[model samples]
Target: MRVLSRFKASTIRRWLLAVGAAAVDPAGVLVCAVLLWLGTAGLCIAMLLVSREDAYHQAIQVGRNLTLVLERDIVRSVELYDLSLRAVAEGAANPSVMSLPKELRNQVLFERPTTARYLGPITVYGPDGTVQACSIETSIRRTHRPDVRWFITQAEKTDAGLYVSAPYASRTAGGKIVLALGRQITSPDGKFAGVVVGRLSIDYFRELLDGLSVGKQGGMAVIETNGILLTRLPYNRNDVGKDFSHSPVFVRFMKDGAGSFVGTATIDGVRRLYVYRHIHGLPFVVGVAPALSEVYAGWRWRASWVALLMALFTVALAAGAWSLMSELRRRQVARAQLQRMARRDALTGLENRGTFDEVSRREFLRAKRNGTPLSLLFIDIDNFKAYNDHYGHQAGDYVIKRVASRIASRVFRPGDHVARYGGEEFVVVLPETDAGSAVLIAEEIRLAIYELDIKHVKSQYGRVTISIGAASSGEPDTVDEAALIKAADMATYDAKSTGRNRVCWHTASNGLNADEHIKNTEPGDQAHP
Candidate 1:
């Protein structure tokens, strides 16, 4: 089992290494890593935004559900109270109520069996707005009618069997804010008899809202269709019956009829996600709102962790890419040094014979294709064998290096090549040069070497000198590289045979007798056919 586990681990490690090598190109690794980091960061940001939006939606949904529940609760309570008012109005309209005693009449019309806690005593008003009957003994003696807003509304709304009034201060209930539900009572002849009004304490709604699960900064409110605030959670006495017609939430609610929004509450100036619902059968709206900060608390924590991880990932990738690029650059520099060593002559620091051959062949082919003249110069050290015998091999090597340097310096031009061809011999190739120009350049090189004045007692010149044989091919396509080399070699041999330390050129007009042509032209004169 141990052996199998070790084998699997090694295989996995090797596979990972192979994948890394294939995927990471040093030149583009940094770019790819940066793009990857940006993409990841963008994805994280997108996720954070999505999460925030989802949280907002969820908060709105919670508020909407609470709003719906409150709406139903308030509507059901008002409808129940309206039924009580209808019963009182019908009873008060009966002729039997006039015959009954005042106390019994009040009992029959105002006092009824009920289970509501916040319901006030029912009051009956005459058509002239005078108190006819009251459930409370103290209110019965009062001469003036209640003079509440519901009395006017009920009188005006003859067709409406029931009417709910906006929140107002109740005189009978000691000036406490309350809501009224009233029904219009009519005579047998269809004349307006009076109104029966039932006042409900605002504390009922305030206590109901207090029992709800709104967050620490959350709130709830009930408003009439005319934009009058009826009741609010964390109830402030001044807020009751206040106008909210200009508020943004109320305006939108009125326009959309029913919807959700995010806005600052007009009551407390707290920013919240608000959900509102229009009561189905009542002239009122209910809203539940929770603070925005509480909704996004969890998302912020998760986003922080995501951002931290993305930062660490970006840093690691950048560091790896830098190290890889640095290693690749070092390897490239080492390979270039090796290539230079392979193609260059060690002593003279010029091209070796192999590199020379390759370059010359390429140049020759290019010149042939273009119909340009190409020239070759084969240079031999004068009395090099005798000089080596006298000065020893070390001195011969020094002389060879000095001569190669001089030749290279003289033929410095674009497309010109200089090489150490063999023992005691150097070669130069000049492209776009004719026989006359080639001979002129050869004389210059010969003179430059002769001027070096290296002591050579056994030589005829008494100094280190060179013998140059130059050959030019104007029609390079018809003349091959070997033919051109052979022509230059034969000219070099003739220069050596005649006298060392001189320049000679192979010319077509000379008919292979270069010596005859050399006799007519002066030492520094241009070589002609």
Candidate 2:
């Protein structure tokens, strides 16, 4: 009985020690659990937001593409109609066509079979808006003369290339809705004669729009520059020629000339993404709208799957914390090692471009906060490509490794950073350094590489050398990383251009002047024999 009692006490003590090591206070465990739940919830919310943004952008792109397609189609159709009008106008002016019999004259002026599909009877109107000739065999004296906007526009604005009128009831086509495209006719002496007009069937546009892939609730529309609805898909006869000036989409279109937006349709109350564009050289705006639900349907499915996987992950993490506490420490160490490897270059063992960017941003923020100066140096090996071609890539790789090592050794300050910008190019970041100090360090780096004495027959120096460009930011709060990099790169190009094996500092005043290049010997330093 005593032995059993001792065993029970030992088991209890081990349990107490495990619980104490895991967390001193029970509230700590509870807090950790609550934090984990919150993290999972936050992750889900972030994913949903990102998904929504992506969907919105995709819808905008689709709207833009659709608008372009519609614009091209409309422009092409109008051009086709204009071609026929010009033909008729020129034919009417010819003495031979006017002398021909009425039947042949009609056939010659208006290709009946071709024009019948898209246009009503081709008519020639006098300056008084009286019909003078028609494609059909009808006496103009008996036909009622109609005074319309197209005839008036053609007579008043003779120089206007093409005149498109508002949609109206067509008398010749049995009261069908149609619009007229008129071209002015002038005598050979440039005198205004009359106008040749072609009535375009609105059904042609309706049919064309119906063939598009816009879903059931989606629509296409044509609006005059004055915010009048000329025509629309789904073809509501009453809505034709209605004033669309009050619509949000129309207001934005008028303001910006061309753009996209999301809004609920006034006609159907369906939410949609609308893209509008002004037709080039025309007084019309074309809009294509697609339902938002259809655009984001795939994204919604993906979000659902993401939510499920995240929930599973949260549960798994909880289980792991309870059962594998000791293994957690080992995994953490491994994760840290992996992260370090990801940020380091494999061959040179220096920080990579990604690491350089991250560290530079952090240092830039620190400098800005502390009101200190920062400098950057861009380094390139001279004639390295030629060396690679002559000595083989292996030797080229060796040179790069050696150069990277030398640069890493020279930048010894804790705040200083070095990175392999790319093949044979290195970047060094120095904190709290002024232009003068940065230039001195660049010269030191140039000398260090010169002393290595790697052979390169293609090089002018007969040994591998480097060119460095240094740029310093006097006020960290004012300058960003991109500006510093651009300045340094330009200075490096200048170093290569003026001479190899030199250091150059960027100066805004003189544009990399000669004074910024460092000579071999400085003040108080002995010249080499």
TM-score of 2: 0.52
Local distance difference test, candidate 1:
0.80
Clashing pairs in 2: none
Error of 1 at 449 (Å): 4.8
Residue 19's lDDT in candidate 1: 68
Top-TM-score structure, candidate number: 1
Model 1 misplaced stretches (Cα beyond 4 Å): 1-27, 96-114, 130-143, 213-219, 233-235, 267-271, 292-302, 338-349, 352-354, 379-406, 420-426, 446-467, 475-478, 489-502, 508-529
lDDT of each: 0.80, 0.78
Measured with C-alpha atoms, the lDDT of residue 190 in candidate 2 is 78
Best by lDDT: 1
